[model samples]
Target: MPLEEIQHWTWVFGRAQQMMLDYSLREIEKARTNDPETPMSGFAAAGGAMLKAQTDFWSDSLKLWQRFLMPEEAPSEARALSEEIGRRADRDKRFSAPAWRDSPLFDLVRQSYLLVSDHLLKGVDAIDGLDARQKERIRFATRGFVDAMSPSNFPLSNPVVIEKTLETRGENLLKGLDHLLSDLGRGQLTHTDSGAFEVGRNVAVTPGKVIKRTPLYELIHYQPTTPQLMRTPLVIFPPWINRYYILDLNPEKSFIRWAVSQGLSVFIVSWKSADAGMKDVTWDDYILRGQIDAIDTVRDLLGVDAVHAIGYCVAGTTLAATLALLAARGEADKVRSATFFTAQVDFADAGELTLFVDDDQLSVIDALANDGFLDGRYMAATFNLLRSRDLIWNYVQNNYLLGQDYAPFDLLYWNGDTTNLPALWHRSYLTDLYRDNKLVQPGALSVDGTPIDLSLVKTPAYIQAGREDHIAPLQSVWKLTEHFAGPMRFLLAGSGHIAGVVNPPTSGKYQYWSHEGTAATLSEFLEKAVETKGSWWPDWIRWIEALDDTRVAARAARMPGKGRLKALEDAPGSYVRAR
Candidate 1:
């Protein structure tokens, strides 16, 4: 059955069952009333509560409609629109409702949309003291309803779609159907034109070799582009939820290539795409075999006591936790310095991602563990919902409504490259870090039998947060400074989660903000910050260089198998190529 059909039937059956239960409870209550000594049973009380809630809903709805009907008491938004329509014969061309002023029928349709949208938002707000998750659910549902009702979604109502149909003589609609069928066959929504780019040849094309491999990861040591080099090597820990190639997408935007050109030894931890066999993998396994092992391999290859470590997004949080674990084991000095790129260690205000992460929602996700690993498609869908208008509906219109092909873009290609998450690790992340907010709480979480304490991390830190990031909000990322005992610097980047971090100096695209001193709050830091032109990459490089004094004439680049660990494959390693 189609999902929608199943849902409709489910609702029908649920309502029937509730009605039957209510009838039974009322009969039981009547019998109990005959015996005055008998008290109210649990079932009767539950039915009474349900009845009261239903009554309240109808009462409130009636009051709302009554107020809406009264022109004197009608919402200001509705009144303003009515006044505007009377003044102007033509509607704003920029809006989807251009036909609103064309006829009374169209005007009524537009006004009804506005009035319902206003009421929906006001109604959600009027609910007394809703918890975060409850409020988020309401907002998410409202967005879905509002998007569905958009005039542009319908062929007859949408002026632009109608004009396109006329221009193409209905060819566009046919093409759109084909696009929709293709995506349906793939069992996932198409986000990018996958054919426009190839992995090793164009995307993660930086010249590099995989020197070491674990069941969980492949560590790639990028070739140096300069003759002279800094003594301390830089190892990057990218989020395992997606492929590591995000940092190395294309020549111009590649962070790995830029660091290599700057005479710094670069190594990246390329995580294996998880599957059924990897279902049993634990969070500690990621810390141990994934990151700690990569650190050990890099240190051994470079023959250095410590190296500069960098983590992006989720990897940054894991990296901080790993440092804490190392400190607990008296091995804190192994990392010379730490840099976090749009990663958050604290989850108190983890942004929109946290909305779908409460106990009930997590239970539903946990139920998906029957497949061993959570499907990457599921993760992608959740993220798309965060910015549905752009990520979901935009594609829907192009691929289905308008029959347009996806544009070829490196960043979009990277976005479409999805990876699965091991069930165990996914569950732990949801329950511990997100649900409990345990990382910042000492002894709340343990890795390898040692309790995590973020304050134990004494290594100098550099943290970057994207101003427009919805995944890891800037405020949440800024909380890292409070937990770290070491000297910390925070950078506010201009773009979002992916673009902000991938920004290269050559693009001359976005500006970054840097404060002279760490402030008690993120707001204070932003207020006192000095805006600087260009990418934040140069500032990061300067910070890393300042921490390390030993610079010598660079030696020849280390090839795979030449290092302590033997080379298994070429760049863009086999794990990343996994289906």
Candidate 2:
């Protein structure tokens, strides 16, 4: 039933109860045929107990009402005494039987309580499916209840529950409110789509700065405007979970814009969000058809022999996957150096996310994708649950209690932009990358018949990881240095995942640690690298420039730019436009 209708019916029942005894119950009983005794025996028993207790309370309430209305006692004092009598009356055993339980007066009130409780419980079940963390608190709150008993689960949402309970009526309403509030919170905070990409305005870019390919999969585009013109260009690959533009949030916080002014070319892959058509799009599509193709396009079109390839989060992994595949195919000769920012080539040490990788969870996700895709909302819920306290509680307070509309923050705004993943692709990815941890181990896996071995990645590489990254722990990113056969430099950036990768020197947001010699582990490297102020952008540009020899300018595209590329529907690029 619609919530409003339920509330309306509950309210009507409450008013009717005031007029007579057992009105709704008697009505509900009439709806049944053969003994309403057998099926409703349990409900009848409960109703009988409640009715009896209610009658006793009314008896006392009648006695107290005379005193409460008398001129003797103050109004406030009388009101308090009456409320106390009602409380004691509800719990008294005298009302536990059918004879006195037939008070029509309290039936509507009882119906209201039962109806709301039912609605809230239904909402809680919905929440349980989305957030794993709330399972424990759900269990804790519903403990000892038979029909509404809690499910066994780990306590991820406890902190959220504790905070909510403290904000409302003390213990009296904590259990009921917790279930309802958590449901509202989880529903609001979750999303499953990849990131959103916003292209710089046409005037902002130098004519012909925007570059792309035939199928338009591999793109090396420039956002034109630069604050400090750097000598070399850097390409960034963002995670598939979100769109690529997160690194280049907007004009001010844009790492791309910052890098351009610092004299560096900024090219980013705005990956197309996955859909039913992309169900068959394997990791090879992202590597061979995606990153590798972009590398060739950037290398040939820009007329530069070498440019910097930087990967952020999952994009880092995809970049590494492509690199490893390229190396194994004896194809590393096509490009220049590589950089990974909070990217994991090794998944064994990837932190707390492992708790979610069990077979049961995987199976559940597989079932969800039975129709060939995973819903964006489901994915969003899973990630939000990862940090339930922040995402869940903030929404609960804002949406339910405060009844406020969610204000748009770019990060969250982009986050709410959700996308679907083909079931087959999602299944294969989880099996090979997450559950098996195959890619990190040499020859343990093959991507489209090509054995992926990290040892073959002979290109000069620079890897940056955040000191406080929980998603792709620094230690996990540091693990990449060990398997690479080429010259590698590991830089530890001060901020978490997003901030670390988008670290523009002009932003002054974070410091980066650089070490001279390759270290076996992140801790060892952190113990040795020199501490420096400013963002990692400048450091990276200097490193790439050293690899980039000065070159003559390439011919700019003809006026109106020879239509070497078909417009994949206009502006925000294909990926951003996908969702």
lDDT of 2 by residue, 82-117 (tens): 455445434533222232224332322232233333
Q: Which structure among the candidates has the greatest lDDT?
A: 1
Clashing pairs in 1: 228-554
Model 1 segments beyond 4 Å from truth?
1-115, 556-560
Per-residue lDDT of 322 in model 1: 91
Collision count for each candidate, in order: 1, 33
lDDT of 2 at 185: 75
The C-alpha local distance difference test score for the whole of candidate 2 amounts to 0.59
Model 2, runs deviating above 4 Å:
1-220, 223-233, 554-570
